[model samples]
Target chain A: MNEADVIAALRALATHPAARGLRDDAAVIDVPLGRRLVATHDVLVEGVHYTPACPAGDVAWKLVATNLSDLAAMGATPLGMLLGLTLAREAVWTADFIAGLGRVAALWDCPLLGGDTVSGPAVLGLTALGAAAAPLSRMGARVGDELWLSGTVGDAGLGLRMALGEMAVEGVLLKRYRRPVPRLGLGAALAGVASAAMDVSDGLLIDAARLGEASGVGVAIELDAVPLSDAVRALLPAGEAGVLAAAASGDDYELLFTAAPAAAGAVRAAGAAGKVAVTRIGRVLAGAGLRLRGADGPVALPARLGFEHGRGCNAG
Target chain B: MNEADVIAALRALATHPAARGLRDDAAVIDVPLGRRLVATHDVLVEGVHYTPACPAGDVAWKLVATNLSDLAAMGATPLGMLLGLTLAREAVWTADFIAGLGRVAALWDCPLLGGDTVSGPAVLGLTALGAAAAPLSRMGARVGDELWLSGTVGDAGLGLRMALGEMAVEGVLLKRYRRPVPRLGLGAALAGVASAAMDVSDGLLIDAARLGEASGVGVAIELDAVPLSDAVRALLPAGEAGVLAAAASGDDYELLFTAAPAAAGAVRAAGAAGKVAVTRIGRVLAGAGLRLRGADGPVALPARLGFEHGRGCNAG
Candidate 1:
């Protein structure tokens, strides 16, 4: 389909009143009173972010999921999103992408607002808006806080391996890579509770280091304590080094956060309320860098912490 | 520069407190009570929306300006914006692009919010947020409303010709093409006065037709009444056909609005207050579609209305 035809197809999916029937130059929304608005933008490219063989529907899902993960990290409720889609010359791909976008938007209750569409290499950008009574920030972590993580960390990495044909394409691991879920419920429950928080996109170690840097503290993560799915443990190498490798793999999309030791009970309760698994990974220290520890003691940090753009590391 | 270096450079430009030093996953801002929020997103790709030869700085400027123009059409005040930049492998171009983005953000009082950047084919996407007490809509026009335009309609078209080497590269017309100004002040002044409003990014005739379609009315435009810059008039072909061509050209970034005839004085006063020239070029009729008239009789419509994406028509 051409740009107009694709847009016409998308118009059917924009059911929210704020979308203005996808006719206006922009979308108009009445933000709720007394709530602080949180905004985030994320871009996903074709070859760099996802493999060419990946389904367009999966690409669309990951694009929206990753962006919503940002809002989740902020402990915000999803409101709406604008999509900037640069499509390749594939009509069927465009249709599948829009269908996937609509599906995720409806599932997350983040209605589609308005955005521009263009023709070019496949690069999709989403700007998500949310509302929070008290949003969490990475800078809010304290020196003595306990670090926590939700969900398995390395399934997505194993899924990536399976996608690369290095392993069997099992449903669980492959799903982790193709359709990772954003932890919005747990994040919202953590509002005003967690000292600092962020979702792990570029691997646990790198993202943890970022949280530490933002909070002006240091993180010491126990490698063995890092959560891993049975599929990942079965498929990947065993031991602390394997755990560390999993920690350094990207596209986890799980929440890595810190809270005071006193709030551990509250954190556990919030996790229970959200029906998500919670694990204590490590503690915040009074320093400036990320430290990795194993059962034997302090382990040497890896040469590469996690994925960095242009360094052959994919983002979500 | 790599992605980290580019993000660090952009950090210096993100002086807004809401940006959280560009460290957090998202930016948090409090929208004032009782005001509606307006948002728009646009993407500019290399060799599509703009020529590869265009300065990265100008590309950045036009990207922000065009999104802001959408807000302007809604009579909104600029709040802040998030930028999703997919960069080509050029450090100097990245630096210049960020500099241009920072300049325009400061000039328009729109702060730089947090966004994601990746390395890929250069595609720039911006999502602008704004606030309006009474946002205008294109569905408000009534029969007999006068269609008014702010600023000259054909200058940007002439400027595009200059950029394309079809004419002399004069500063005035070239600047119009490179850095078309958003009529924010005039739009804000017409908040409650304009029956219907939109910006002319596409050709005036095509955009007017869209306004007519949106408002459920027809537009009757007088070819001679369309405003043209002195430079455009001198350099381009002359007389009725020339005016028609100019009206059919795109990227004007001028406001096209309609108001009751009784509000003409108010419209003039608003234009004067905003320091923008206002001219009446058409009227809304109780029918559908657009009608163009010349001095002698009715004029035939052009085969092509205006620029549409993927049709080899450049937007920026």
Candidate 2:
């Protein structure tokens, strides 16, 4: 089997009319009238993004989820996705990836519009297109807004540790690492409610810091308030160190956003509508940089904030 | 020095307001109100798409042009571009690529919307977005329509050979190989007038065959009517073989389309407006395959139609 086989599988999955049955080189989408188009692209390499132990389907899921997560951050409803796949000559792997792609194509209701494929190393490229009338920007956070997170922090990072055998794992940590759920519904719910929002791909603390920098405000995170899953709480290291581990670890794919304090009830309502838990972990402050607080007093910042790709996650 | 530096450089290039200063994870574009959004993606590996002899800037240009070429085929005017660049740990190469990208970003008037980059092999990915009120498709050709081609074919394929030291060469053939222009204006003009439209990225004959297949029609090419550049004409292999060679080469990025006989004048006028030469080289027929002819009689099909990436270019 070759790339043609892979494309045939994708074409079968691309059911939207905009896909043009994958016959046309480009996908033609009727932009919803008066809506702003939201677009994001992300690249994931094999070893860097996933371990060899990770399943092929999971890799496919992560690729789709991670990109849509960007759209989710912008409060955009996903319209379509385009993939640029560079694969090694492995047919079974390609077949499995296609199957995994089909699963997410339905799960998100995001059509596989069309894309280009070539033979090379395992570097995958994905672009997600979404639309929103009142899109939220990271630069829109206000000075007195409260910071919220959609899910518990550091689960995926812990899952990564489990996948790498650095820790003996029980529960679905590995699954969490492999198949992240993009908060599409929650994002759409937060569209007009949130002051600013972004997906937490690089870790909670670092992303919050970025939000603060973008909005020209300061961030103060209460370590006690950083929620941890039961499984993670049980398996974590020590007290302050463990909390830092949770907040600083990346790959969470949670929605980290800011909204006015008076809008807390509305924010919670939006969260309930999306069926995702919303936690207020911090608040926006005047000035710059990040501050951490424990019950005793202000805690010291971690030397390393999060798992940055060493460059601009912002562009992604 | 790192990814932040790269993002900072890209932020400088992305002047479009939709880019949101590259601070957000995704771009928010106002999709021209009512136009259909056209999107296409292409992937180019170092050895597969270019050689060491090809300049870094040319690769960047080719990446942008090839993706835009797909939009050109759909008769869509370009809007913006997103790049996914995976580079080896060479700063100079990265800087050069960014420079080249900036050049084409201005040359095409397509803003650097935003994209993701990572450290890996020398693989490049690009997505070009455009909009059209009445986009043409490969499947829209009708029988009796005259086939039109913009610019000479086989120049880029020959340029590739020269770049690889397979043949001695002079003139702008190498430039043609490095950076073929996308027919943006011509595609826009042909949007409603042409029955069907597509770009010839593969050899003209194979692409014509594809057009025929997609539209459920037959394509008949008159070999003698095929155009060649003066430089290529002087240096072509020989006889019917040279003409076949010219038509069977790929990477021309020329428009190969179909229009009604009555629209010939309009098509020529569109070509004049686009500042690109247009040639009538064939006709759409009632059957379902491709046929070729010379001054004397029929010409046999070549073993290979064009430079296919050995998989589903149809997806592209």
* Cα lDDT tens digits for candidate 2, B1-316: 4777787788889889988888897999877866899999888877667765566788789999988889989989888988897766467667888899999989988888989878767778888999999888999999999999998998887887777777886649978878899998899988778898999988899999999999999999999898899877877876778888888888899999999999999999989977899999999999899999998999889898776654332111
TM-score of chain A taken by itself, candidate 1: 0.96
Query: Model 1, which residues run further than 4 Å from truth?
Result: A309-311
Least well predicted 10-residue stretch by lDDT in candidate 1 chain A? A307-316
For model 2 chain B, where is the 10-residue window of minimal lDDT? B307-316
Q: Model 1 over residues B63-101: C-alpha lDDT tens digits?
A: 999999999999998889999987784788888888899
Candidate 2 lDDT at A252 equals 80
Best by DockQ: 1
What is the docking quality class of candidate 2? medium
- Candidate 2 runs further than 4 Å off: A311-316, B311-316
Give DockQ: model 1: 0.77
Model 2 steric clash pairs = A311-B3, A311-B4
Report the lDDT tens digits of candidate 2 across residue range A208-254: 99999999999899899988898788888857788999888888899
User: Per-prediction DockQ scores?
Assistant: 0.77, 0.65
Question: Which 10-residue window in model 1 chain B sums to the lowest lDDT?
Answer: B307-316
